[model samples]
Target: MPIGPQPHGRRGTVEEPYTPLNLRLVLAAFGLVVCVGLSILLFRMGWTVPGWLLAGWAVVALVDIVVIQFRRRARARAEGGDHSLFE
Candidate 1:
């Protein structure tokens, strides 16, 4: 009774917004590029350990990009047409 807004107390019904897969793909791609570039720079600077770690992360980003691509293709097919990624 002392609050301006009352909590729903676990009975609140909230709908989650749809995730943007295209944006995820783009971000993953950007991450991969940055990780790879930084890894190379670190290696040239003789920071072997961090360089290897960044390289590993770059591989993970690459895999994520591939997985996102597959998901995008499946979603497009399920939607009955091949829509552009930006759409």
Candidate 2:
């Protein structure tokens, strides 16, 4: 479906606006903070921490990359053509 309001023949509320890329960047940064916070909590508790912290960091990084990829794919699809060359 198109990303905006529906066609005139059919009506409902307008679609939600596309969020700015800065918002995604901020969310990614927040994810980093969460990973760090988890690591610190583990450390404070005197548990074996680095191993699990590293694992958590890796998962967050993977998720960040996935979010970026999802944005790229959605933008490309919205443009409706092979726009890779522009990249």
lDDT measured at residue 35 in model 1 versus the true structure, 0 to 100: 100
TM accuracy, model 1 = 0.73
Model 2 scores worst on lDDT over the 10 consecutive residues at 2-11
Model 1: how far residue 79 lies from native, Å: 0.6
Stretches off by above 4 angstroms in model 1 are 1-17, 81-87
lDDT of 1 by residue, 1-87 (tens): 121111323223355334466788888999999999999999999999999999999999999887777767666665645444553
Q: What TM-score fits each model?
A: 0.73, 0.38
Top-TM-score structure, candidate number = 1
